[model samples]
Target: MKTKSTTLLLTAITGSLILLLGSGCGKKTVMPPETTMDGGADAGTPISYPAAEGGGYSEESLPIEGSLDDTSTATSVTAAEGMAEPTEEYKKLYGRSTRGLSPIYFNFDQATIRPDMVAKMESNSEYIRQIPNAYVVIEGNTDDRGTNEYNIALAERRAQNTKQYLVDLGTDPARVRTVSYGEEKPLFFGQDEISYSQNRRADFIIE
Candidate 1:
């Protein structure tokens, strides 16, 4: 009976030792957390990705300033292009004489023929009558107070008024033509009142 009891105790101790060894072998070894390569962040902390290669723009790649000024310059060029071009007949009669009839002057921004210039128109009409099959171009001009476009329109009104007056004085309507010089062909260059008044005149060109 004593021997059997001793054998049972040894068998139980051997079985417990085997179970502990097997459990130790089955467990996995634990490793430490990895850090960023730059070592800037702590372990288990998130690191932002680097900026995309060549993705951002520099100052040199941006659009230029003063775009409004560029637009203004382009508009000025377009306005200049809109001005009237001279005709071949106008080029031929540009510097020709108008006999004794002088250039008729106007008041500031006025297209109406003054009473003083009535005689001049009559004389011009008589001179036209003297010459058979002669045509005359009345060139209207203005002072440099307004824009090219406004001055051109004003000049046209002046020329039309003068041409009508000549036609009323017995001159043939078909023999008369009109053009506007605007402020381009100034009779006097000074900015004073007298110069401006002289420049605001209608010139005669015989063709």
Candidate 2:
């Protein structure tokens, strides 16, 4: 019986030790995996952002470095100081009456010739240069946005600038005249961007 009791005590102690170990008597320490510079990625594995042609990393959103294009260069051009305003006599005559020629367009509230309209100006100037003593009456029109007087002034500038550009392209300055129709003669009547844009222009008339 004494031997049996000792055997039972040894079995109990063994069971208690097993239970203690299984119940996590001591906490286990876990070491994190090693990481390198590629944002916590392993040294052997490299992660790339903003893929290039060969599936590699590239510089972020770099701008192109160069001179401006023809259109950009044209837009950058400013109206000359002499062509900035009109005199009282030119306004009074209304450029008189004349026959129709090719029309050139302008941007909203701007007297500067757009790049697209540059070709038209060149062709029109060629025609003026070819004709014998041909006179050009530039009639400027504007969109129905500002006041009548303001629109008149804006339209005047448009005509004057167009005339100045034509003169620069070899047309005689004396042969060219300018008139501001303002919002009076709108080709398009609709209240939209398309209509408004269409109205902002300078039409050439030969006298």
Q: Which candidate leads in lDDT?
A: 1
Count of residue pairs whose backbone atoms collide, per candidate: 0, 0
How close is each model in CA RMSD to the real structure?
Answer: 22.1, 16.6
Per-residue error at 206 for model 2, in Å? 0.6
**Which tens-of-lDDT digit does each residue in 72-102 have in candidate 2?**
2212212232222222232222222232246
Question: What are the per-residue Cα lDDT tens digits for candidate 1 across 1-207?
Answer: 999999999999999999998888665978645556566546566444444448754544444333322422212212323433333233223322364455787899899999997887787778888886888989999999989999999999999999999888888899989999999987567889977887788888788
lDDT of each: 0.74, 0.73
What lDDT would candidate 2 get against the real structure?
Answer: 0.73
Clashing pairs in 1: none
Weakest lDDT window of 10 consecutive positions for candidate 1: 71-80
